[model samples]
Target: MRNQLAISSLMGLALLAQTPIGQAASNLVFCAEGSPAGFDIAQYTSGTDNDAAEPIYNRLTEFEAGGTAVVPALATRWEVSPDGLTYTFHLREGVKFHSNKAFTPSRNFNADDVLFTFNRMLDKAHPFRVAYPTEFPYFTSMGLDQNIKSVEKRDPLTVVFTLNKVDAAFIQNIAMNFASILSAEYAEQLLASGTVRDINMQPIGTGPFVFQRYQKDAQIRYKGNKDFWAPERVKIDQLIFSINTDASVRIQKLRKNECLVTLNPRPADLPALKADKQLQVIEQAGFNLGYITYNVRKKPLDNLQVRQALDMAVDKKAIVDAVYQGAGQLATNGMPPTQWSYDDSIKDAPYNPDKARQMLRDAGVKEGTELTLWAMPVQRPYNPNAKLMAEMLQSDWAKVGIKARIVSYEWGEYLKRSKNGEHDISLIGWTGDNGDPDNWLGTLYSCASIGGNNYSMWCDEKYDALIKAAVASSDRSQRSELYKQAQHYLKQQVPITPIAHSTVNQPLRASVQGFRVSPFGRNNFSGVSLAE
Candidate 1:
């Protein structure tokens, strides 16, 4: 029951030594929830706690976690066609496997590897999609297979991707690690049997870390891939990702030096961890929105005036202060400020009780119409103080003569119900998928993606048209203009109120040199090493 809020002054660079503490192994112990639960690179989807697949899988291009646009990972360099419809990538050479096998006669990564990964995503029998059905279901049926004009191997060193049309976001799509290149030779063995768990379990990728072993609900081990292309930069010799679900337990491990890095540390643990001279905290603002969504497709919420009434009734600033404890800021626009397209002209939801009462009365929800409010478990911050928000709204709406009931569910199941639009109102948080404004707006508001993550089920044809145009147009300036209009429309409608943009409260042991938390939520350890 302690709420600690203090920032440590470890702002600049610190020296690292080759040797580590305690174990001769020199492993960086990190505590987080084991997400994706399994080792299939293709199956790894976002959410949950663990960044399990990153070490074993190498994407064609990857954003440097905390850094900007895609930097070269597996592919050494690439070129675009004169028409912008095709891309040719020249692969890096001499990357050996964890199996200690010799580099194939090609001496470079090949087109066949990329082809296998894309085709495998379309394969219905694959278990990779099973790990994250909601998110990847669209990937399987993304219509990329039929639309891909062709995929040709120019030679061992080059691969060509020809699209049916000039899809500007194609590069961004490949940057998604889901399009990670697989070993054609190994994948062939799995395809012959029409199953791939065995090969996926033991992945072979050209990354800094090589998979060692995994113990379910306990740990996953990896040894450094010394022969990696960027060997000089990837200093860490090994990484041991420990699965510690309890937030308090994770913090204690950081204090005891049992773990080098602790993610999602409770806000209360910050001051104590800062007091421990051997520890530090890096607080970065993120583009994540934590809001209470009213499923407008369902009964009470189906009423527009009622939606407006609730929108006007809730005090977002108070919630941001009391619940989030000033760890985050109030959101005025649908898109988070981190996104480039967030328009500054949009207004925040004003707390107007008189307006809320009039709107509810106009909606015909007489004196005591009871509504059910849904929430998630209190473990992680999908509104740990959601009951407080619900109670506040219940009292606010009562001034307008409406009654409210509260309900809660486990995180995963709660997400499922919210997706189905089954609840009147539910609390949810959205982290940016690819650091793009389109990622936030398109996923939540695009009519095409309804019932997926667009839990509110709010629809507007004009808004949908503008979003579609923005996605298709390749011009950055024009696209930005169109999205600005789209955001304005969303603000006027208010299907979901823009709540608080929460900050990540991360704690790191002082020995954990070069450890930093990324807004993107990727566990980047490229610069990480132990203090001497």
Candidate 2:
């Protein structure tokens, strides 16, 4: 029952230690759910990437650990233009970037570093992006280039961003994983030597931790940045991200104290974790959503009636109860209720098999119609068990005279293939990168995300315009109304059917201290310390 809210008192006693106590072991091992796709969070959308990036880099602004409140991070403070189209950030002084065997930083973080980070994203012709042409799913998929007009350095410690139009969530967006600042000097060195690919393997940043090495899909190691700009240095000397795909293996490792912490412990294992006096569990309302997307470009799914039919035929309530094991709630709308301006009033499609059959019949999708359902390989905050969900969907769909072919690939391959439009209907979702409605609506459903996040390929001018108008205005009331209307449009379109938002549960050993689960579903070890 002890969660993040109860950890404040425990933290007060050990807040002074910049290293672990009693055991002579300053290292904190984490049983990460999955390996990061790459260190470049700007280029990926999965939480695995965020988990790795959060410790290695800092953003201008950040969502507080275990909370959604935006706080000053790399940039001490910022100013917004009157028209809300421009933002100026004051970078913190004397913040040193991490130095390792791969690359060394000759100077501290400054405006030039900030310029390199944003410019590489905003400018396709920039040498960094051009030299290392990796896919930027969260950036390009979110239509950032269209929103951000330019990024320029005002001085050594000041950076200014000019937007094409007003975007109320701009600051929160900057706090996202994709906005993690990189050392421009490091990029230049790598690009000049034709070893730019090392930037993805070895990251150099101004965060509290330093990236040591990453053994693909196995382990990612880090050490504390002693010269971090923050007043208090990182409590843990070293951090290890142990990539283990099996939930049971992770829990076993946690119980044995092999790793001080484990991410996303299966809901079924919560009882044993809480009962064991040596272990402690953290639980909170997750700011996330899980959904099933019917790739409408495919046969039968091309019909709106068929999409709706598929939506109505699947019993979400059954899947939530069975697969989640009491860890989640049936999704109300496309986004979780935690998102600001989220339209909680909108409900998912009513489960009516009779009506679904009729709808499919009207669309000329006869009985015994066959289609593929792509499941997810790894468990996530939004979806703990994609294969189970797919099976449940298969059963529900079978009752409606549809033959479903279930398929899946490795986690990384699954995302790549899904984005490439390789499936009929796929299981996918999001843990809001930023605490903004635009992070959900505009990033996931907008036509601009067609080749990336919007795998369903649902594009409509009305939906896009409403989202555009919502972001253009700084008025909360106006934006709320626009978001509500957009939600109705999303439900009408039937591109994706919302599933559930899970209550994220993480388990840590009693020796571990100061660890908390992020509402945004990220893992942070900057403040963590291990004790005997």
Candidate 3:
């Protein structure tokens, strides 16, 4: 029986490696961490969603592969006015949008497509937005709605943007995944057919890959865009994102040669994976932060003393030791140490359960107070094991006479519920989208981010003002000073307890080539190929 089972496994591996009708050998299967909340990146903020949209779409500008340097994508070239309020972009000519069963493009990508993409997010009464009510979380969180005066079409190939004030990170912000351009022609077709919501389900873009199909929590398939503007970059014939939430299962699939690449491998499994000759493990210091957000809107948590007490009770060192298993560093600031303007001087509250208990009692928090603790269902670079971390936190809070009930849901539901301010305290983290201080300060804690990525539901006028001043100025010294002050202020507010900055690890088959480790935690397979 054992011999027969082994033979069956060998036959399956042989079949996977064979070049079948669709050239299966040329196809790359990535063991994705979780399913995307939606295909429309503008409506979501998670990395899983960004990974799903990246291949199927292109931003006006894009971060250089494996790095944060901004470069032209759909736009061939761009210029900014000296006053920094106006910018102009020249679109790449003859770029064709993907065609599907639903709609086909009548014209190449032009200024109208750019206008349609931004207007839907900027204008509350946009025709498409009105028909399909949704929130542009990343756009609103970054305060682009307030900054962008208008996105006007100069011509078929030219577009101009007028800003209300100087924003140093404006170019980098638009390069993010949320700013991926959409097909205006497709939008019009969907609108005319009364299928506006299909825009998210059946995406059409001018990127390296065309959307084929998606089965929730199962797999998302794509075919290489033969009409891609950068034809040389699209190496693979097909791309498949095999969604797997369990790290152990993803690793097993990779070992069996069923997957070409996998993300966020468990730290404990690194040694054996490194020893395997058939696999290669890539590691890099991730630009991210894992933290516990205390919903300031919740009772008892609204008090600063209660928040401080809860923060002090948790043993961050223990969490680092167990959850990360030597793959992460203890984080003290809201942003990671790798980011510019990170204030290393700010200190985390020391672990002291006795003082926390007294502080909680003084703040009128009764003994055995019940509180809900939410854990992430998916593993992220900054958080390898949220369930273990949550369990540890529950134990620590119990020492302070607090009863923490750990709770979790599906990845999409978890994010939605947390954003709706349903959880008392939730485990959430962020990877830097752009290499700007404002990306961390403004997007996570500003008044505009209240109903979005600001899981803490914290909006401080002073902190917001500091970040505003920082982004307004282009001077490095002045921006650095203001950002440092903002970090210190965040430490004092205690809206979130920053935990760890982890080292991202990617394990792939030895045959995989040109796989770059993105600091943003994005899985981009444009230049990747499978070696025979």
The candidate maximizing TM-score is 3
* Full candidate order by lDDT, most accurate first: 3, 2, 1
Runs of candidate 1 with Cα error greater than 4 angstroms are 1-25, 37-45, 97-109, 122-150, 194-204, 212-217, 366-372, 378-410, 420-422
> If scored against the real structure, what TM-score would every candidate get?
0.82, 0.94, 0.96
How far off is residue 387 in model 1, in Å?
6.1
The 0-to-1 C-alpha lDDT of every candidate, in the order given, reads 0.67, 0.84, 0.91
Q: Model 2, 495: alpha-carbon shift in Å?
A: 0.8
Instruction: Name model 3 segments beyond 4 Å from true.
Output: 1-24
Q: For model 2, state the Cα shift of residue 530 in Å.
A: 2.1
lDDT of 1 by residue, 479-515 (tens): 8898999999888777887777777766787766666
Query: Who wins the lDDT comparison?
Result: 3
Lowest lDDT block of 10, candidate 3: 14-23
Better model by TM-score: candidate 2 vs candidate 3: 3
Tens-place lDDT per residue, model 3, 43-88, is 9999999999999999889989899999999998999999999999
- In TM-score terms, candidate 2 sits at 0.94
Residue pairs with backbone overlap in model 1:
4-268
